[model samples]
Target: MERDFKMTAITMAGLEEVLADELRKLGAQNVKEGIRNVSFKGDKGFMYKANIALRTAIRVLKPIKTSKVFDEEDLYEAIQRIKWERYLDVEGTFAIGAVVNSKNFTTNSHYISLKSKDAIADYFMHKYKKRPNVDLKYPDVKIHIHIHKEWLTISLDSSGDSLHKRGYRSATNIAPINEVLAAGLVMLSGYKGDENFIDPMCGSGTILIEAAMIANNIPANINRKHFAFENWKDYDEDLYFVIQDALLKKITSSHFKIMGFDKAPSAIKKAQQNIINANLEEFIGVHHVNFFNSKKEVFGKTTILFNPPYGERLNINVEEFYRKIGDTLKHNYENSTAWLITSDIQALKYVGLRTSKRVPLKNADLDCRFVKYELYEGSKKMKKQIDIGE
Candidate 1:
């Protein structure tokens, strides 16, 4: 059995707890949540499972070294001191991604990455008289350099190309939500394939696809072609397949309806194509209908989630658009719950519905709110009476 080691899963803001829960459910040890990440201990097989199954994780990083550095020279020296020959070969290629937030260094992340790269190259040149090449697009070794205040952590990027690139989205709209974010939102809403799922303003069908996957208990990255760990010298191909097969066997079919809607014919077409790419055409349906004019089409309890335009990427009347959203939900939709994320705070007030829950989240670079509203079959008082009678 491989020895357990510490690993960190990075996620967006407001999703640390969600990611931590995911790690714990996967049988991680000493799970802990941080600001935008979760740390835990797991073996090599567990690491592979995490990369393949975590829906809310952006990337999984394995920290190899930690030190306190005061300047760029210290950073470079500290990186060079590590035995690079263990992780990369003299003839192979490598890449460095850095994030610096320190008062001691006035330089930016780009310069820090360059300095780290030079240090690694020089280390190889000194030992073997030749250095490895740097390939940004595809590299044998991908390193992550994080500097906060005086603390520095050097880690290996195990999940390559970010877990958000689930390899199923070949077609995308102008402002498609990140796959991780979409999955996170669906998980946060507490939908587990038992209830009908709908994305009223579904763009490219991301939320719809993620919802269907969750309902079916499908592994998040089952469709992904490769991971950075596959390039590692210690990678166990047989063990990876074993873990993958276990996850595949856990998948269960969901009968509840999962649907998406868009006013644009082009968006509906792209969404259908992407759904087919995911091999989920039988589970999800995309329709070309304006959300403002549509009503609840499925029976029983329904969960409606969407990433509406916030007047950030698309041109629209922000206040009136939000008002119409509230209006449609209040008058048309019944026996359902709705959740929408928007960066427009002032416009949210125009929705005119009392929110049951509000969460702060970040979409791309914009600060946003994920608000939930419950639409009853009749009045709240009448619904309460019905519940009391039951």
Candidate 2:
């Protein structure tokens, strides 16, 4: 636990590079981006910091073993060879989740999980005359199995439940964005708290909360209830607290405004409550006004990032709504940069303004795009001065 070890951070499909950047900033070594995951080398203290600090990561996995498996028996034998006692005990509880991406394995992933669990149980039974019980909901040890075409990896879920459940948001809207996705969008939009930020269609204030956290340098999971590593046999309470204190001490004041606007009164209320819950009321504000009817309140340069109705969430005229968005940004929100994420790509054509950047992203099961529209000052000639990559 004192030495450097390999760790993998799982993220959204399009956030691998973002997660890698975050890991590198946190002093992780040998950071590499893979498909929906980032692999890095860090000691146990870095592991603790990554769990609490990474904004784009979903879960940090500490791989205990990796091997090539031909069949179910190979998987079981490989898992059994591990010294499970190091991570779990007879009186403790454990759970396993299997992810299978293989043509050779036709069995259900749940069946694979059961087989792996059985292997561990048999190993402990033969060795110590007792076995750990399965506690699916609140397990002391959580194991994740990944089988990518016969290559098997067993990892311990250090960040219990996803890190998306950052514990500050006690309320949620009907179509609220995932917390990790919200934070990732803000990070990808390149807003570093240097300028004023806004979420015109903020549903439950997730983007606003995440933006405030980013600006203030707050640990992403500071409010999280628990992490699997807390219950590990080698858990270091003092080290974890030291890391937390260091991260907390790094928080700096944000001078710029972070605001959100929603047409619905309920959404505004929920957003306010969530902002207050995150202790970010000083930095964020929620308003119950339709974004289309309102002008940019902030005088200086503004960074607007929002997830408007994609015609799927909340009924709206997709074409007309996108048109209005384009009009509002082009006319009222001058000298600003606006970014929006939507699954309705075809509807994007209604927004007449040319997007400077179009990033392909995935939100849950829907294929989405995170697009950026530059709102230049003055006449149309300003568009020529702006660059695509700028």
Candidate 3:
């Protein structure tokens, strides 16, 4: 019945291979990628590290059981078999989140979760005569059921909340990107410790913070307040401290520049506050300046990664803003690899530059394209007619 004898499953957001790779670097063994989650084998200490350090993982789950269920009846039986007393007491509250992707279970995820909840409640009612209450917001025990075809994998949500909540940002402007997605974008850009990084529209300084951590080889979750491992019944304090110390020892000094720019003074202030909150003020700088008016930095091999306003939620004129972005990148920034993520496919074409690479990425419900443009100082790479009509 020892916790170390059981296997753990770490769940992550989908299409975030770079984030999965980051998990592997942190000493997670048997790291495997699925649709929107990664399954890795680790002990309690590694679980703590995964919750604290994984940038792209939404939550880490310690899977309790996997079974073949043909119907809801079979699902109930599978749930009833597990010894839930180890994870939750009769006084504690619990919640079930079901993610179904099978032909037999064609209903919505909510309905599947309802059935699983009923099974757990019935089991506790029969055994203890008083079942645990269901607390959706803050549950003592959160269960995850991922049904793929006939296989149903039940896991305990080790991370109560998503790992993206690093507890740094106190404010957010319109259309702020998720911290995990921002970190993934930083990783995908391949900007290591060698180059200067800039986020012109760095709302809340998420990209700049993530970039600084990546450049300095710092643990992503060092600023976070809590991890699921802290709540575990068999938590090992000494082992967790050792892992933390080892990761801290690997931190290298970052010599590269990480700069942020925002036209709004309010955004700049918020970004600076968040940067300071993360204890990265010494490594990062924030300034209030319109990106269109700003030129490339003095460093020739600079990398600019940003999430510009898409005018989807904001009330900006899309055509003019897109034109200005293209104008700024083409005229001011040269000999740099500039990348921006935008969900508007139409607006991306208006950039007026040949895209070196067009990567498919998702921003919540919006399917976005992460496009890159290589700007050269001379006319050698500039075509007579730089077409982006396609």
Candidate 4:
């Protein structure tokens, strides 16, 4: 029988609760949310499932040890005491990544990573007269060291290359949003594929693909080629296959319409190719139509979610672009809820529409707000009255 152990799922700042809910659904015990991460308890099989199924998590980590240390010597000694031989072999390649938030350490995360690497290498050298080589790109055993004040926690990265690389995007436009963030945006909008979904400014079709997966109960990493747990010393190939098959069997067909629209012909082509790569071409349709010129074409309730340009990566008139978005949503997209994420706080005033909800989020280094606007089937006067009532 597999013994239960604690694990952590790292995510963006605002999606911690969403990740915790996902873990609980997957039968995780002692689920707790923290800053940019969620901690839970599960066995080995559950760890594999989390890697494959979690959409909002960037990576899943299995902590091996935690210790209190004051200086670099203490850090090195603590790392050396962990039985590295169990997780890694003398002939295997390994890498260490560090995150430091301590006033005691004057060095940065890169230097801390280097120091931890030396300690691991020395431990192997002293025991067997030879040490393993370091492979930063594809390590056999990827380790993580995180320091918060005087407490340091060491973990084994179970999901390598980050879970955001879903392996479906062979083509992307400039400043493409991360896959995890795309999924989180879809989930946050409360769209479960029961209603029509549209990405007005879909770039590379990321949101469209993620929405199709959610609607059809598809596993997040079904198309991913590899995971770090497969390289572990005690990896069970048969068990991994069994878990994967179980998740695959849970997939269901979705009939709701999922579509993407982009004014750029290049963006439309990239989105179409990526949709094909994800095997979701049958479920999603991409068109070269500017959203401002298009109206809600699908019937029944619909959800429109997009990551528009905030004048950060793409060149655009921030004020005018946002104002057009408000005009289009109010005049064209009737009986639909529109949600957009942007970093320009001042530009939001030009939108001219009262937001129903606003969520604080971070897009890479920039602080963003994911705001929602509800569009009812009415005239401009009625809409103004509705806004005034709110």
lDDT of candidates 1 onward, in order: 0.94, 0.92, 0.81, 0.93
* Model 1 C-alpha lDDT per residue in residues 99-206, reported as the tens digit of each score: 998999999999999999999999999999999999999999899999999999999999979999998999999889999999999999999999999999998999
Write model 2 residue lDDT over 53-138, tens digit each, in one string: 99998999999999999899999999999999899988999999999998878999999999999999999999999989999999
**Which ten residues in a row are the worst by lDDT in model 2?**
381-390
TM-score of 2: 0.97
**Residue-wise C-alpha lDDT for candidate 4, range 1-390, written one tens digit per residue:** 989999999999899988998899989999999999999999999999999999999999999999998899999999999999999999999989999999989899999999999999999999999999999999999999999999999999999899999999999988899899999999999999899999999989999999999999999999999999999998988999999999999999989899999999999999999998899989999999999999988899999999988755748887888899999998999999999999888888999999989999998988999999988888657878887995
Best by TM-score: 1
How would the candidate models be sorted by lDDT, starting from the highest? 1, 4, 2, 3
lDDT of 2: 0.92
Model 1, TM vs. native: 0.98
| TM-scores for the candidates | 0.98, 0.97, 0.91, 0.96
Question: What stretches of model 4 exceed 4 Å from their correct place?
Answer: 379-390
Error of 3 at 119 (Å): 1.8
Provide the RMSD of all predictions against the true structure, rounded to 1 decimal: 1.1, 2.2, 4.1, 2.4
Clash count for candidate 2 is 0
Ranking by TM-score: 1, 2, 4, 3
Task: Please tell me which model should have the higher lDDT, number 2 or number 4.
Answer: 4
